[model samples]
Target chain A: MLKINDLHVKLEEEDKQILKGLTLEVPAGEVHAIMGPNGSGKSTLSYVLSGRDGYEVTGGDATLDGASLLEMEPEDRAAAGLFLAFQYPVEIPGVGNMTFLRTAVNAQRKARGEAELSSGDFLKIVRAKAAELQISPEMLKRPVNVGFSGGEKKRNEILQMAMLEPRMCILDETDSGLDVDAMRLVSDGVNALRSPDRSFLVITHYQRLLNHIQPDVVHIMSNGRIIKSGGPELALQVEENGYGDLLAEAG
Target chain B: MSEIAVKTKAQQTPQVTGAPKAVTALDDRLAAMSLPQGGFSAPARAEALSRLRVMGLPGPRDEYWRYTDPRLFNVPGPQPLPFDAKAPESPLFAQRDTLTLVFVDGAFDASSSDELALEGIEITTLAHADAAGDHWAAGLYGALEAAGQQPVKRPFAALNSAAAADGVLIRVTGTPSKPVHVLHRRAADAADAVWHHVIRLEEGAELTFLESGMVGARSNAVIEVDLAQGAKLHHITAKRAIDPKVGLSHLFARVAEGAVLKSFSLAVNGTHMRHEAVIDMAGDDAVAHVAAAVLGDGATGRFHHDDTVFITHGAERGESRQVFKKVLKNGATGVFQGKILVKQGAQKTDGYQISQALLLDEASQFLAKPELEIYADDVKCSHGSTTGAIDEHALFYLRSRGVPMDRAIVFLVLSFLADALEEVEDEGLRAEINERLEEWLTSHA
Candidate 1:
């Protein structure tokens, strides 16, 4: 469902290359995790795929279901079934969380030439989904991520992913600021959305998140390139030892 | 003593022989226009006229009028424009429960207005009240406007007081069950209209006053409010005008002990528009809040909007807040001048003022002057002003969620004005005003 080839990215303001000759693909019905040490361009890969600004894509071709994702605007990419769960969800001071979600959902529907969801129907589905994530109605009414705790922001991101239901989901360090309980809850939410046609690119530095939501494939990323590919056991091996051995092997 | 020395010094310094040409020209224009006649209090009219003569119309050089030129308003005759008699898509404050008063070309339209009386409240047109003589409204006609003419001069308000042809007088004896709405509809595009409204909330009484619609091509309006001890009043106004219209409104309010006054104004469009407010806290523990949300977009790149506010705490334990927000696009200009003053005996006073603007493009501009004067040592006061473009990160966040770029911009612009909109006390009114804001955004964005 997602494909990348020889991707090279650098900071637009400075001549600093973050992603160099990186290539990875997540097939339909499969979940993949990318584990790397600090400054391995793990986050940069996700941002580039999601069409964030301030990144100069000097070389690369990223496609979603045979559509050139690199040439599309951010919203068009989103409409093409791409979703990014931000590592640090932005704190929008005055846009209500519910309003943001509804606008997003309806905007995508309209772009795809589908009828807009009625407010009544929207409310019913949102309430049910919010209950599953332990998000109170009050939190839904408050501004998006403003004054929200770290766990709540993460959960909100998960809720957005569930609402958008994108075909290709990129989880950028979703486990960084979460506690054990929160990580478990978030993992459960993601695991419930698993389907035959959906794919996830889970990026993290630790293997603890994979324990809850098992990955079909694990890739060791270093120096902006995936060095090794293995089964789920690879995550456990890294957690038990560390990235030091993997770095030496990749070198 | 020193007083005699100062008098001698003033006498020695040769005073200017005559007023500036702009002042004299404005005075000549005022002299040419006939003052409103009939049952108006003679002394009040005389005093207001005298004050207008002395102050004249403010010029670009005036300290308070530095950002907003008063030239457009000083014209001798109304500049004619093609009038669109068709009412707005949705007339504001049109509901069954509210008492609706209509003004056509600055004159009361009794045929279109609702009943003149309501339970617990008394209402009468200024023309009728002035003709009746010795009415309760006589005491308040221009009293608040006269009292507000201190520390700063509002020549336009004085001119409005002296020249307004007709308006309404409202007196609330007790809590009113419904609000009073004044709706202005212009049929003559080139008509110049001036109106003065006086409202008195009796002790412990409560009322809501709502004003909407554009008055005329060249319009000036003054609203005077006197809140007795423990009384409460809520005032909301919305002004939406197309190009080639010049509008000015002044609100003067005095809050007594334990009284509360909350006023909000929303300006959506205009060639040139200015709204000024002056509030005085006369008794201890009084509270006052004044807020405005303005949006200006000139298709021809010639729109201007100004919101000037002055608040004074004259008694102990008083509180005042001023919030002004503006969104300007397409080479439009927005201005805000706000001041907070705490008197010597007004200890424990709390004052807060904030003015912000969102410039949609490089050509759009925002000018703000915020001032605070405190004679009391034990008071809490703060003022802030900011001008910037929309948050790029927030814009991206919304766009990444599949919202179109234009829609995302509207969301952020509306969010910028939400803080000022929150000052509206009524949820229903706030929602209506927000809908109007959304409509404005849809057209401009």
Candidate 2:
């Protein structure tokens, strides 16, 4: 479970306020969706939660399982069961996909005081998860995200999530740039990984991904603050009417 | 030509046991042909020898001689090892049924070398080939001597030309069922050494020549390779010199039309090592590739390197690529100069070059210069050079993942050298090079 309290964040260099007086909480065994139009600071919130550098926390704190996540480094946050599926993944040449994934998985495991997996067992787990996600082995052999198409990169991010088995996973614009069929495959992969002890924060600009993911709670954000929250129907309402009404209510 | 000042002290000067007078006369004869008197013919050979005389023996002042000082052999200089020096026991060629040619201290060790049993392949020493009226063997001996009339500052290259008696000549006539392996080594430990090796790949012939300088002896050598029409030659030279005061090495190569020349030089040790390679794309559609990985530690090591590739349109549609990477620690230094020239008539020429260096500490040094001259408008040519320390972010990333500081540095350093090592085609040879790399990192770390 994760809780964010009165979080106020500003741009590091300019000190321009982005997230002001925002508070949210997601308990275990639940799915939450944050929907907002462009420039509403939805993506910024995810980055701040994950402890990415260059984001100043002007006010409150973020906690993971009662532990302060704000005090941890980006990698430390990752080791403490936090994963962020980037909107645009950086391509690192000469670092093979399989090698990167293995390093990340082992790093988290070591941080949790678990023994490292052998090469044979690691290959077995990677192959099974790749097959389920329809990712070819050749993709795993190339450098990390180098020359991968939009949909394939997204699927790879999901594959890493499945391999890591993090406690809280954040998906930012996961459905963008994906064909309808690819969207379904990715949503299916995410749904399969859902469990009682794990939670997901699915943030997107459109309602198309909701058709497959079916989040338990939907929240509308405006200018970095949550303006409305309701059941799954809230997503359908926003999709039919757009964010015009929500913007007015928040203002 | 002035009396070249041998950089080593008088005591360690090269004392040619039987041929001291011959070397002295040769040196004086070269001096008499000085440019002031117009006695020197200014031929490629004359220029090369004069340059060698000037370099004498590399001293410590030359920036390129920093890590590898030739002064340790000061008292005796360099002397050709006895032709009868015992050859070390190596099973490299015995496993593959390859034609083995052995050389000790720059002279052909005929008793230890085996004759070629393969059909249509002629593998013989330069002396034997010349004795059998092999005109090609004599013609290409000093063919690639540095063309410019520049003063010779490298003593080993000059010594190799002056002292080389019998060199190895490998000629692949018809397409071979298996590649011919030529192993030229400097195994003599007591004295300074010189060996000249020449390999020619004739028309439409394909061959792989594996040359390893694994001998820990002090050596000054020249290796010249020529490829005829459509001939393909892959040359891999591993420089693992262990001696503390050995001079540098100079390598020269010439490639013809539709001919493919690929070479990789691995310099892991040696007090002062310099590998200078010049390639000419004489025929249309010719392709040449040069790759090297150099590692230096301890005292200042020098890699006075040069790669000048000329792609002429008369040999239209030619391609040339050069990649060199240097990894230096302690107070060692590296120098890399790469140039690609595309003549005006050479349309559709593809030329690319990249030189990168990674310095491990503040005391270490790295310098890379990449140049490109394009006269043809349609040609695609680009050159890039980068010198920097390791990525702090990546290093931190590895360290936070539980890898200790030393292991993390090794990972990043090896990743930088991986590009050049990939050019090596043989799996076994690659493994050997990697083993040396691992040892170097562990010892230095």
Candidate 2 scores an iRMS of 4.5
DockQ of each: 0.66, 0.14
Model 2, residue B224: displacement in angstroms? Answer: 0.7
Highest-lDDT candidate? 1
Worst 10 residues of 2 chain B by lDDT: B1-10
Residue B358 miss distance in model 1 (angstroms): 0.7
Over all chains combined, what TM-score does candidate 1 have? Answer: 0.95
How accurate locally is residue B70 in candidate 2, as Cα lDDT from 0 to 100? 46
Q: For model 1 chain A, give the 10-residue run with minimal summed lDDT.
A: A87-96
Question: Best candidate per DockQ, number?
Answer: 1
Which stretches of candidate 1 lie above 4 Å from their native place?
B1-20, B87-89
lDDT of 2 at B27: 59
Superposition error at B336 for model 1 (Å): 0.9
Tens digit of per-residue lDDT, candidate 1, span A1-251 = 99999999999999999888888889997899999888989988988898888999999889999998988888988998999898989887657899889999999989888899999999998888888999999999998998899999999998988888899999999999899999988999999888999999999888989988899999999888898889999998899999889889878
